[model samples]
Target: MCGFIGFLSNTNINSENKNNLTNMSSIINHRGPDECGEYIDDNIILCFRRLSIIALDSGKQPFSYDNNNYKLIFNGEIYNYIELREQIIKDKNITFSTDAEGEVILAYYKHYGKSFVSKLRGMFSFVIWDKINNKIIGARDPFGIKPFYYSESSRGLYFGSELKSFTKNKEIYKKEINSKSLHDYLTFQFVPEHNTMFENIKLLKPGHILEKKINQKTKFEAYWTCKFDPILKPQAEKIKDIKKALEESVKLHMRSDVPVGCFLSGGIDSTIITALSAKINPNIKTFTIGFKDEGYSEIELAKKTAENLGVENINITISPEEYMEAVPKVIWHLDGPVADPSVIPIYYICKEARKHVTVMLSGEGSDELFGGYNIYREPNSLKLFKHLPTPLCKILKYISTIFPEGMKGKSFLERGTTPIEKRYLGNAKIFKDHEKKPYLKSYNKNYTYDLVTKPLYDKCKNYNDVTKMQYIDINTWLKGDILVKSDRMSMANSLELRVPFLDKEVFKVASTLTLDEKINEKTTKYLLRESFKDILPEDTVSRKKLGYPVPIRKWLKKEMYDWALNIIKNSKADEYINKEKVIELLNKHKNGKIDYSRKLWVLITFIIWYEKFIEEV
Candidate 1:
């Protein structure tokens, strides 16, 4: 519910250097407009902008603990602070504190070191300055629900809730594309962990902690991770445990002192959240975003779901024109390039919700936890198709390329015949390996798809088919694409977005279930629905997961085609990308030779971001 920026230096500087930190924090003022505070000590400068969600009057930062030996600036809600505080008081004899999560975090760190992150349950990205050790310890939430970006420069180590905060540092030059991150961003919609467009800047991996030793080395370590732990419990026991855990998550997520709302998307995930939320408090307010197009709008469905649950539903309708208009502003808030078109609607929805509430609950991590995406259903088909001889498949892939681009079934044949290592580049595969070869400044065939999927693949080496897919998503799609967009979109509007589905307790319970319960040849999220079969309406339980459908494809073909073509043509990215090749792709897309919506959007987003953050430099 707040945004904070902090710095640790090897030496002190003048007013001009101090103003850099001030400017960095000011850019994200919308994230915490209620209050602003700064802390400038011997070798550190900590700044905070507070949104005042919980302990409004008392929760201020940079809050110090152990009599100012350790100071902290945190940007998130610690749902279990009340429990943590009580445990600390009883077990550790800690005393004298307001009921704020920030204070508990400081005390916990004072006692636990980096181990404290594993004990907390909430969405957070925080920095604690240990004056005693002269070190900065940082941690991000387990599910990547919160964002933390850091860059090391001659000035010092600067960290913030968003990348824009580091823009004011004169020493931090806008370096060229980090190729590894570029590959991931093109293959997926967003860049994966430890990779940012700028060479030195990086995203803190989820479930990981970074320890920067004074005037020396910085080390990153993973403190927690979710694993598929299949239990032998009976169905009845599973249902009871699921209900209990989910109810607890919903209740904890609503621990704010101010008004909170839920994003009801007319899907099983949102319905489950709304159903549980209303059961706790029927006055729970919910918001849903719908489009003018019937193909994308889920307003009616969300309204019915809300009505059935006896919760108030506030629906916001966005027109195509309006959605396009919000693109630049949304892109700016995103900080880096992210091509998820839904971010536009999310921005408007959060903007509207902020008018009524300071915090909003969203169903973000459900798909990754449970098997919800349609792609998970393709493994069997892919496995069968993988039987073809490599040489024969390569021949077929080459021939398929000659078939008119975007022709029906061409993509399937191309993907099916190609090897998984070469064809399946995470979920949002935009450009082909060959297509990127000519575009990248320096293409490295040495870099393979294993770069991103290897970690999860190795982790799930002993797991079942479904569990492998789940693990793959958790490491790639979940953190790289979904959580990145979720955090950026919500924070863009200065609204605190909490994902009840991502609660560690809920993850612990869900991860224990086998693949058979989660998904089979018939359907996905079966076990999840059955657990709440009695609570959710019949229609809700049986409904298929229709993703937040955006009209980007339709817009690219008509309304936005000219604007997009112009961007592609004029992009200074020609220095990195092939201008002629890009123009050809645009023309083919305009001529209906290719259904290049996703690819075009990714390219345009990257170009715009590059121009804004890199080219002008």
Candidate 2:
């Protein structure tokens, strides 16, 4: 619901540092244009920008508690604050001065110490400065629905909700690209771990707590882990539990003081969210976006669902030119490169929804949480690997290399022979290990995507293939890509986007679903469909997942060919990227020799980001 930036310094604060803090906070004003608050002490500064979701008049932050001994600057919603407040008042006999959620957080921290985070639920990233103990405690939400970035410099530690905020105070921090992260970005289209595109700055992993005291080493630890534990239960009973949990989550998520709306799409995830939300509030508004290109737009399907639910549907059809124009701004808001074409539609939809509603509910975590991706079905198709001997599969993999690239069944053979740990790298696989050698000038043969995935895969070794993939995504893809775009795009428009599907209660239900309940031979999210069949339209229950189908592949070939080529020719990333090779790929796509849209887009976004953050700065 907001954005925050601050620093914990090793020395006393000065006027220069105060000015820098103001500038740093000013840069992210779009995140919270409603109000601004600041708290400064000898060694720490906390600046907050409010979006005014719940406690409109009384929620101004840098909330001081315990006789002004503790200071808290928070950047998310505590959906259960009302319940927590009641418990605190009864147990400690406390009198609150305001209805702000930040007060509830401070009281809980006083009572529970470091363990307070586990007792709460909702998406959040916050920092609390204990003036009494000269200590700092920071934590990100369980699913990373919000962002928290920090850097440890000689001056001190600087933290913020967006990476761009650090750029405003160059005196305290230096801007240098992290080469290892860039190398990984080429393969995964994102920095898969805690390390970010910048060298010193790092993203705090989800469900993790960071503690730092003055004149001591900073420590980080995980307070929660997303592990799946399926229980043996009847299908009908499980379905009933799922419906109840999701309904409760949605109802809680709609606890905004302002008008709340839902993002609708042709897919079932958004439809189900809208359907459930409409039942709670009959006059809810839904937003959708699509393209003019055939087989890409879902406007009609979304409209049909909205009509069926008796809600007003506001929609737009983006032209290729409009989509191209928004690319640079989208990349800037993202704070780094994310090659997901779906981000464009999300950006536009958030902009549109903000016009009517201050808070929007999205369906981002459903795919990762409930095994909704089509690739999850790959394990079932590759069952032959389990039947055949390892040596024979290796031989088949070798034989597959003899066939030409893109030959029928070639990728299947290659993947079937390879281990799941090596073959699967979350949802987006832009450049493979061998493919990056030609495109990256600083490519290290030893550095590969495995550096990020191997440890995660090792943790889930006991899981089935389908469950392993889900675990990997819930750890990497869900946080790195899906939530990044959702947070940045929504905040860029000053809109508070909430995910009912990513709630703690809903995740507990999803973790217990069997593979048969999640995916069958014919469809994904099987249990979800079965649970909501009577409420949703039949086509919606059975519709395949086509999440924001962007026609970037077609645009790169025709409409945006010259625009993309211009960026490739003039890009200043030659020290890191091989421009000639990228141009060749772009030429091949335009000439219809290959469909290199996804790969080309990855390079284009990074180039634009480089220009914005590196060259322009």
Against the true structure, whose TM-score is highest?
2
> In candidate 2, what are the lDDT values of residues 167-270, reduced to their tens digit?
88777446577888988898888887588888888889899999988767679999999989989999999999999999999999999889999999968999
TM-score per model over all chains: 0.94, 0.99
**Model 1 agreement with the true structure over 138-181: per-residue lDDT tens digits:** 99998787888998865578889888777766666466678777
lDDT of each: 0.81, 0.90
Flag clash pairs in model 2.
none
**Cα-based lDDT at residue 401, candidate 2:** 88
For model 1 the TM-score comes to 0.94
Candidate 1 clash pair list: none
Superposition error at 370 for model 1 (Å):
1.0
Q: With candidate 2 superimposed using the best TM-score fit, by how many Å does residue 176's alpha carbon deviate from the native? A: 2.4
